[model samples]
Target: MLEISIKPEVLGYIGAFPLTNAQLTSWLSSLLLIVVAIVVGVNYKKLPSGLQSIIEMVYEFFQSMAEDAMGAFGRRFVPLAMTFFLFIVVSNWLGVVPGVGSLVSIHDPAKAVSAGIIPFGAPAVMAEAPPSADATVEEQHAYVPVFRGGNADLNTTLALAIIAQVIIHAMGIRTAGLAHHLAHFKNPLEIVTELSKILTFGFRLFGNVFAGEVLLTVMGSLVVVLTGKLAPALPFGLVGGAIAIPFVMLELFVGAIQALVFAMLVLSFLSLFVKTDQSASHH
Candidate 1:
């Protein structure tokens, strides 16, 4: 049985803020990026080798892609595009790593139930059976996963989308004067188009990542259940290994493609706005 919840589980708190499992994963991803950046900076070389060479190659690849998209102006936005691509691809891949979804946090069943966090009819395993006569009344029994993929959370994806849009608009204003940028919005439909970009950008990444996570969960659960019934002595983990490997590879490809798609779209939008301004200026 799978216990799938759309909302991210609350793991704990930081001062007045509630920290979610997805947010925790996002924090870890950011930390990982920071450490890698520091290492690359420290190991800089006049003649690139090893990690520095790899970093240089990746930078050149993205830089060339951006150049092809927006010519000279693209150089200014390469950092933004590269950041989005790297962060999102890493975050997506992290979700598929072993132990990420397995670790769980225990909570008091009575408190969890009273809080109305669990639905009216959820799997019994999610909250465990009622405490036995020998058990303490306040014993914690409910278990929730401690980590989830960052992009699987709507809040994270939406935040990324909002940031991208803000940068796009800012670039527009910088390339064209504020008055000219505002003039484009005089048509009411253009305002609607701008608003629609938020939903399009946010939901595209969120839906794909979230759906992939759910599918993997369901597949793993099914394999375990089937294996347990067929062979009581055999470990389900071993038996399910064959079935899980292909999906893992598929997810890796999907993650990279999604990252590239998002970065390219950002570049395209920026180019569109800039070109529009250029044409207006010549008139």
Candidate 2:
């Protein structure tokens, strides 16, 4: 049965802190970026070739886009924008791969079934049956995923949004003085609007990525169900797997677009603040 969880399931704990599948995925994604950076840094050549050429092309593309967006000021932000774009796109696409969402088990059979996270009949095949009437069910069960997309989790998205907003505000203050930046917030509505961006940024990324994850899961599950009904001896979900190939490709495009959109929005917001600073300086 397919399970759609809004929150990333707690896989385990490291001392007092609980580790989530989303966090694990984020860490792995960051590690991947770091490894790539190190490899590119070590293998640099005046005349680029192969992976180096591709890397240079990507850097040049973002550099040009950033420069076009905010003039000279944008050059200083190229690294941050590119980091967000690359990490997010990689993480989003990773979620579309096989075995990411499959290595999950029921955390709480009764609760999951009650909450519609698992089918009522799922308990039959679950590793452990629910406790008997007099027995106590354990509070936690092993519901861990090997990998999950970082952008699909609200925490990851919200944190990114908060960080972007903080950088924007800091840049605004540095460019146009704290007093001048604060003056814009003198209007209570303006304050509210700025704060509301957290929700907007977080939900936009979370909703899109999460929806894609759920859609793939449901589609795959439907394939399994249909195949089982039509041909009981047929391999489970094989037909569904073939059908989902196109959707996987679509997800790859969507992931890249979402990353680009996020990076562009950050650049746009920075540009707005930069413009404000420029206007105030003229006064």
Candidate 3:
């Protein structure tokens, strides 16, 4: 398993509030996406090439998927839905990158490389640490990165879930009305009963994405341990990379599927709320 510690302060403040790793990751992801988008947009043309073509293909596929899920009317929400999907898919795949497990840091500089012990009077300074350390080698404190896949982090998935659900509510209200939307909770005997189901929508998405991360983690560990001792040839970089190719592709598909599932669930839930509101109106 990859374990990285990140100083909370490294991420900039959000109106005097420091962001969490997951939040920082989200910010970084957004920034990187913007840069990439600008690069692609600058070169966009009638006959797209390289990154532009890849991006266009992804957009088109999601456009089709959104339409299929929400029908012709769904196309209006395509921009928001597709953007969320692509962002999630990219972040999910980032977890499997080679350095994800290897990136780490040292909290102390001198202690990181001292002769089995830091001098009592050593000055305190931040020092770089290796991602992995050798047992025989002393004083090399191993470091792990603070950031993991945004999707792998429960906070990120949950935030996304909440945002998605909120969007659904907003869309529903716009289509229906505020009185109808709010009435979803009011008519129920107890607010607790109504609120309980609120968690279900978010939790389902969280569970699916979280489960994917767990499965990938377990499978990756097995691959490393099994290949290390049993088959040297199998562990060769090219062979290992080939073996991993399938999983990477699988992640790609899962990313898109999960995004679709999340969005579809949102639409379905909104439809239910619309119905509930309409029913209350009649009664």
1-283, model 3: which lDDT tens digit per residue? 2222222223223443444445555666777789989999887799999999998887776567655555555566667766776677666666556654323344554544441222234343333232345312223343324455666565666677667666777786886689867777675664564354456645664565556655554454455556454332334435556656677668767866776666556555544544343345545
Residue pairs whose backbone atoms clash in candidate 3: 4-144, 4-145, 104-143, 104-144, 105-143
Which residue pairs clash in candidate 1?
none
Ranking by lDDT: 1, 2, 3
Residue 146 lDDT, candidate 1, scale 0-100: 76
The C-alpha TM-scores of every prediction are 0.82, 0.82, 0.63
| Candidate 2 lDDT, 70-176, residue by residue in tens | 76667888898898898899799878878777655566567554433333334332334333454433345435464788888999999999998999889888877
Q: Number of clashes in model 3?
A: 5
Pick the lDDT winner: 1
Q: How far is 124's C-alpha from truth in model 2 (Å)?
A: 19
Assess each prediction's global lDDT (C-alpha) against the native.
0.77, 0.76, 0.57
Question: How does model 2 fare in lDDT?
Answer: 0.76
